[model samples]
Target chain A: MSKVPADLRYTKSHEWVRSLADGTVEIGITDHAQHALGDLVFVEVPEAGRSVKADEPCAVVESVKAASDVYAPLAGEITAGNPQLAAEPEVVNGDPYGAGWLMRLRPAPGALAAAALLSAAQYQQLLDSEGD
Target chain B: MARQTPLFRLHQELGARMVDFGGWAMPVQYSSQIGEHHAVRRAAGVFDVSHMGVLDLRGARVREFLRQLLANDVARLKTPGKALYSCMLNERGGVLDDLITYYLGDSWYRLVVNAGTRDKDLAWIRERARAFAVEVSERSDLAMLAVQGPEARAKAARLLPPAEGSTALTLEKFVGRELGRWFVARTGYTGEDGFEIMMPAADAVPAWRSLNSLGVASCGLGARDTLRLEAGMNLYGNDMDESTHPFESGLGWTVVLVPPERDFVGRAALEPLAREGSPRKLVGLLLEERGVLRAHQRVLARDAAGKDAGEGEITSGSYSPTLERSIALARVPAATAGRVQVEVRGKLLEASVVKPPFVRDGQSQI
Candidate 1:
């Protein structure tokens, strides 16, 4: 079973969100998503200062088998993408929720509330229902 | 529902991720694909390739029939236990399938073909065998395992009886012989010294367990694919199919057109194309930049002036664990050489066009 930390918020597409004290929200793929993707060989993170809408494709994660897109969870202006991922993509496989975080964003006013992301329990329920 | 192999339950018990491949539910990976890939390249790994079709041909004229059926000259396989790799072609010189033929004896030859093309290959062979009165029997009661790496042969040899184990150890490369109830061949798809063992279906589970207990890592289709790609071996449908011929598919070496009078199924059609070189040739590409190369990615060739020389397609590609870089086999214009650009997700990445067998014997050849 994949980890669903009780403190984090999640989206149906598998991104986890952590609100920071600086009024920014951090985003990265959930453990479940990383496990499903297997060992990551390359990661293309979005650049800072880009505007993205909810569920927009903002990054790419490639495994030996295939490549997949990571999407923005809410409308926001990008603050930063993890610089470590470019040189060591496998860190995401080892520490997906911590050091492997993809990007941070400053939400366009009230976008987080409008998006209505899922809680840990709701995400777990979704994963169970999907039979993953 | 996908068909299951005899070792299906074992694979499930091992926590393998099952996937549908060519109508068979096979293990794509037991754990990390990269780990399994490294095991094969550095140590030993075993794969259950039971889904591949095994056909036994029997007749007084079996050798003669093969000469007509296969693009390679079966006459070259004069010694029993000698093997020959060949392409089975359609009447129009299109590749039907690529297979390895073992001349078991004077009246018997065994063929192992790709799982995806099993039904089609069987029908084609059976239909052609009618004129020669050869019997084509599908040996569905058999199971095959490929144990590959530098230490694969020695480790796997420990599983056999004393005399037979020594015999297996002494066998030369590209040779196979019947040892008691098993047929062991010193042949493999990966560029490593190993064995491809065929045993009765009932013995598969136990054999797999024994191999595993002997410290042979259990690998799946994911590693199998990457290992073959790094070794520069071609996958059947991905590299070539009914629309492609041997001359253009990097398999011209397998086709034998010598002794001019001897006729094969696709000889007439292939002769003219061979005389005047094929328009497209298959070559290897080594990505010089970041990002992974994948099948069907557009490959752009450029001339000295940076003009668009031609456009080709990647046949099979993946991140090569051995080389720590992305490598691919591509069908490009015959004149394409030097450097090429691959379009990956809308951005063109530079790649070098080089000779194949990117890694051999666990070492980078390119």
Candidate 2:
């Protein structure tokens, strides 16, 4: 299983969002998402300062086997994208919740997270259920 | 409604995300495909390749039968454990299946072929074998696992009977050895050093757990595709079917016509194509643009006329883990080279033509 920190908030699309004090939320794919895509090779993220709605395709993760999109977790304005990802795509595979973070966004104050998103415990439960 | 390997139950327990691959319900990824792909390149990764068909071709006249039937000469396998890769063709030179024939001696040669093409390959070979008084039997009682990577041999060697690990690794490439009930071949799909182990059905469970304990990552079919693509190996149905010739599929060397008097199936048909040269040749495509290439994608190459008028297609494509870029192996007109463009979903994508085996020993050939 991918490392899912209980303190982190996750989107149903399998992205973990870490909220910063100044309102910029650091974004990265969840352990589940990375595990699903397999061997990640190339990643393309949206430019910083762009506006995006919740669930919008803000980035792309290409694996040696297939290509997939990284969906935004909430209605927000893109603040930054991790340029380090271009040089080290597998960084996300290694430290998905840390340096593998894809992009940061400034969410609208009082706007709620996507309703369909799951908690760490819930996501782990889903994973176990799938095995059965 | 797909077939599953003998180790399917174990794969489910390991959390492999299964997918339909050529009608087999196989794991596409276990944890991360990229990690597993690299594991084989750097460390070790194991693949359940039991889905590939294993056939025992036995008869007194087997040598003569195979020499006349296969494009590659089987006599080279005079050493008992040697292996040969060749295309079994029809009378018109159409491929029935690309298979690896292992010389087991005593009128028994073991052949392994693609899972999807097994039925057709068996029927065709059996029909021809009838003329030479031979018998073809599919050995479903066997299972195969490919432990691949730079570290694969070392890890697998440790699992053998005492003092045999070194011997297993010492076996030369294209050679297989029978140790107890397990037959291990130093051949693999990944362009990395490893062994493809064929074991009896009963021993699979114990072996799977043993390898897992040794830190060999359980890789799924997803990494296999990308690794093979980067290695410039051809997928049977994608690169060539019965209608496509071996010469056009970048495997002309596998065809050897010796003695100047031997006649085999498709020799007459291939002779004309060989003399006149192949119509299309398989080329490696390195994407100049940032996008993933896929199979059946049209590769736009200029005709020999050179006025920008010809058509081609991508037989296999994927993101190359070793190169960290998307690449493809395409079959196009033989004379066409230099820079070529692939039409992927109505978009013309630029790709460079490079000699294949794009990645070897975990390094980018480009």
| DockQ of each model vs. true complex | 0.97, 0.47
Candidate 2 lDDT over B1-366, as tens digits, reads 999888989999998888887689998888777778888889999999999999999999998888888888888888988999998887778777899999999598999999888887788788889988999999999999999999898888888986577789789999999987889999999999999999998777778889889999999888898888888898888898898889989888889877557677778888888788888899898999877888889888865455464678889998876786778988887767777888864578888888989989788888
Model 1 collision count:
0
lDDT, candidate 1, B1-366, per-residue tens: 998888999999999999999999999999999999999999999999999999999999999999999999989987899999999999999999999999998899999999999999999999999899999999999999999998899988888998999999999999999998999999998888999999999988888888888889999999999999988889998999999999889999999999888899999999998899999999999999999999999999965556777999999999998888899999998888889999999999999988999988899998
Each candidate: fraction of true contacts kept? 1.00, 0.81
Residue A8 C-alpha lDDT in model 1: 96
- The DockQ value obtained for model 2 is 0.47
TM-scores for all candidates?
A: 0.99, 0.82
- Which tens-of-lDDT digit does each residue in A1-132 have in candidate 1? 999999999999999999999999999999999999998999999899999999899999999999999999999999999999998999999999999999999999999899879999999999999897
Interface RMSD of 1: 0.4
The superposed Cα distance between candidate 1 and the true structure at residue B3, in angstroms, equals: 1.0
Q: Candidate 2, clashing residue pairs?
A: A38-B33, A38-B34, A39-B33, A39-B34, B93-B266
How many clashing pairs per prediction, in order? 0, 5
